[model samples]
Target: MVIKMRLGKTNLEVNKNGFGALPIQRRNMDDSVEILLHAYENGIDFYDTAHFYTDSEAKLGKAFEDVRENIYLASKGAAEEVDEFWKQLETSLKSMKTDYLDLYQFHNISFCPKGDDDLYKAMLEAKEEGLIKHIGITTHKITFAHEAIESGLYETLQYPFSYLSGKQEINLVNKCKEFDVGFIAMKAMGGGLITNSKASYAYMNQFDNVLPIWGIQKLEELNEFLSYDENTILNDELKKAITKDKKELGEDFCRGCGYCMPCPQDINISMCARMSLWIRRFPAEPYLTEEYLEIMENTNECIECYACVDNCPYELDIPRLLKENYEDYQNVLDGKTKV
Candidate 1:
């Protein structure tokens, strides 16, 4: 089983594991360069970054300027207009020191681009200018993905997908396959909620149409994915792990996509909503320590305004879930349950 899959119509054949550069933005330049170079040298050829990721694209520029042609670089444009799109495209090209990108995506837009919009015309003009080889879209919205595939606009769709994601999300991957649209799986580790890499590998390996990009900021994380065999397969034990995760996680948990951010109450709804999983899945001390405890406690400020619920792609009952998780956290802290 060759672990490489050709990404839909663009036909960019990538390993099941691609490098996600969002976390790279948090690292200093030197450390970013080291990890990126290591990833490239070790057979990870697909690199995904975005203009909004702060220094991520710049670090990629420094690390791979000499050999940009050897890798598939995908970046996203957050611009909602024609002029801003061009500006962002130029910034990305200049940052990466590249003339064009293998794929340029509309970053998490609420609606699909259309011929009626200035952005669509700009996309065509950019493709004509050879500034972008392929146009794609990334969104947390499942309905928008269906619309994009139906419109036949995007060559690829990047979305949050992991072992914890349920049937509806998996259908998005399969729908992309049916429509010949590339499926790029983000949040493969469930936004750090899933601690098991081998299980992640086994789960993602089941879909040849889907290519998962692991967000790597540390050496250990990168090494975990890199250490897998080329013929990686999901064994019975891994299947059991997947089933157990789904049962415990249920349907209403946060995927941690951060779309419900900028809470008026200054709360971090993403992590706090999933606090139960973080406590159950990883080391207890790091999260239960004073700093994270403060962050989690801020959910007490939630006014139940439904702002987060509105933005959530899953339409989760966020305020209610936050309260539930907070109550659960208090239990573990009180020695009622072990982490």
Candidate 2:
């Protein structure tokens, strides 16, 4: 029942329950290390972090420096140019206290990196120098993900895959299997929208080629995945849960990938656009707080420039979504609508 899988061309045997270190950045160093060490001790070894995730890499560094040989470390860089790529690479290495990354990915890119591109060449050089073991690409765009797999450039494809994924996302998983590119699933819990971890775990177990790195920030969250490691068979009950989630979530919801960010108006587009979902799926109190109210209020400042729409991989009308969520939020505040 212990889950393990091979990462396609990379051939790195990994535990099915990979540790996503992004959320750990929110935890202080000591607490982060404790959570990380707890996950590692529970047989989760394949750790994924990124240069953009503040000090997540450093926290991993502190926790596993002594056990470095026993774990697999993967970090990503989003630099487009050669110099910037190197700088990010060095920074990640220094931050993670690692000599090389087991999997180095082109994080959240819209287009696939080509052989002629300087960034791709830099990856090759890094590989040759043993700074990175395998090259991978992570994207939210279905078309671009297909292009990455078909291009045969990436050793793995990390994209958002959950029970709510529609035909295209499921087909992308099949394509990765057909192409022998490792399928690393991000947002497997639908970026916290899909709350049933057991159902998510079982659904992911059906795909032998797909690995889900559950983002863990606390002991309970880590424990949920660990406890399910032995019971991850997709049962009739779990299937029912998946079906219920799919029907409710439907398509056209944000994955909260944050690709459309740094809004000109300083609005938190990712959170604001998905506020309706968050309030309904999670506790309404958090969003109702003063801090969150300020964030939600900023949505009104949007200039309708469609910069967010331009960057959204899902092609969400971000400005419009923001407007709608703001209206709904007002209703909640006024007691006209209930969470």
Candidate 3:
């Protein structure tokens, strides 16, 4: 049987485990369409995408043209102004090949300003115009998430939720339940840091209302989650493995939220964190090139303006971590270590 969960304030129902379209953007159009159709055929009905995920909306639009009505489509807009918001909403609808959206979210509104009334007003107008069925917001900041629930404007909240999350982070799940707001969990695998799929699935499965969208790029990853229905619960060996992973992961710092993105120095903050994981996990991947070393080393160029530190959801010492990663990346580039 397929797993299903209810999205708040709307009549729409989605698979408890859904597909996240972030990783699939890396693939070609044909490959992306093939993977999306495969997901749809395998009982995945809830698809999440955003305008920022280059060509992701177009790929989904092409793949789901025939079965658009049979699935729920959630898309987000990052526009701050009403005109841009409306433009994005229309673009999203046109790109998704849908007349109306199942859920329209304010993409990554981390720090909502005091007089940001136009954004909410536009969302309401969109709903009235039948452009959207429900309104939602996605944020990495827990404080903003709490405020979203309190604001009563949004029907759902999407954020990071995984076993690595602390009590404060997990508390969002409880708050969503209490507020009757749907909780769509992103980065469930810790952005690929949590290597143990079964343990990750089991941990997420314990929560009834939280839906974790696994960013499945390959058939192997899809099959792994699809296989969990028949698998047993946390065994002793599995517990040991999870414990070992937790210890190695150390204290949760960066959530890979991409808030530190578009660094004025052109440093890719998110990929830098992932590179650290690659060094630890897949040391044999040959894509870690000398050019990649330059990007990592650019972390040393950080002006220490504390922009990333202030914006980080996990409150990580981003400059410090980037410095450490630069050293490690240099070691890997120097043939002293593998990454």
lDDT of 1 at 300: 95
Candidate 2 ranges with C-alpha deviation above 4 Å: none
Model 2's TM-score against the true structure: 0.96
1-339 in candidate 3: lDDT tens per residue? 676777766656787768899888899999889889988888999989998898899999999999988998999999988899889988988988989998988898645523258778888889999998898889888888988888777889998888787788788899898898999999999877788889888787778788888988887888888777524467788778778877877774455678877788777888775566667766545646767767777777888787877777778888778877777777776788764
Candidate 2 weakest ten by summed lDDT: 225-234
RMSD, one per candidate, in order: 1.6, 1.4, 2.4
- Per-residue lDDT tens digits for candidate 2, residues 67-168, read 998989988888887899999999999988889889999988556888998889999999999999999998888887888899988899999988888788
The Cα local distance difference test for each model comes to 0.89, 0.89, 0.82
Q: Rank all candidate structures by their TM-score, best first, as comma-separated numbers.
A: 2, 1, 3
Q: Give every collision pair in model 1.
A: none
Total colliding residue pairs, candidate 3: 0
Candidate 3 regions exceeding 4 Å error are 110-116, 230-232, 284-288, 331-339
Model 1 over residues 1-339: C-alpha lDDT tens digits?
226789999988877779999999999999999999999888899999999999999999999999998999999998997789999999999999999999999999767897677898898789889999998999988888888888888899998998888788988998999999999999998888787899998788888898999999999899989888656678888889888887888877788888998799999888899989887777777788778878878889999989888888889999998899888888888888787
Runs in model 1 lying further than 4 Å from the true structure:
none
Looking at model 3, the pairs that clash are none
